[model samples]
Target: MHLRRERSRKLIETFKASLTSFACEACGVDMEAIYGPLGAGYIEAHHRIPVAQLEPGQTTRLADLAAVCANCHRILHRNGLMSVEDLAAHLRARRGWPLAAEPRPEDWQGPDKG
Candidate 1:
């Protein structure tokens, strides 16, 4: 079935709004964290089930999508059929570390000075 552009766009907006921070769901890489102000609010929505594999008349659910950074998105496309959990595990293994600790208030270097 052909997915409507408007529907896809709406899904992406909804997903972004639902997230606390616009970070890659898989590896937790925030665009703003890496690129500073330039990367604010940047993320790509990935269909959990590849659109190409959807059967005719099938419905798309919000749960069927995830917000990913460009790097993760590209890896997903290149590797094909890999789940978000798979990529997260690969990243953790590649880095030889578990998820990093959350930034402390004193450790923050953003422009907000109060």
Candidate 2:
């Protein structure tokens, strides 16, 4: 029974992970472009909020994640990142995509901070 429950938990996580890894939640770009960027794009899956910050017993939604290139993921999460929504919104606007109809919040200072 204990092992069964553990398997269930892992399966759930795997399903959620799969849902987010196929696309770049940040730019809506396909994972291929977000990852290796060429012959074989190899994107990585990122949890929007760090697992350490999650409330006890809480599981993050797959939509709250992103599939990004290794470098971008490192830049976005070198320290601790809250979420990439703001940066995503900015990129959206720059790309001329239909941006959020509401205002966007400021992104927290991340690894680039000195």
Please report, in order, the local distance difference test score of every candidate based on alpha carbons.
0.74, 0.54
lDDT of 1: 0.74
Please list the residue runs of candidate 2 whose C-alpha ends up more than 4 Å from where it truly belongs after superposition: 1-13, 31-41, 59-64, 78-82, 98-114
TM-score of every prediction relative to native: 0.78, 0.48
Model 1 C-alpha lDDT per residue in residues 58-110, reported as the tens digit of each score: 75688998888888888987896688888878876776435522323333345
Worst 10 residues of 2 by lDDT: 100-109
Q: Candidate 2 clashing pairs?
A: 36-41, 36-42
Candidate 2 lDDT over residue span 11-98, tens digit each: 4466545762444455545434323446243456677666566776776665655665455567577645635676567667775655
Error of 2 at 7 (Å): 8.5
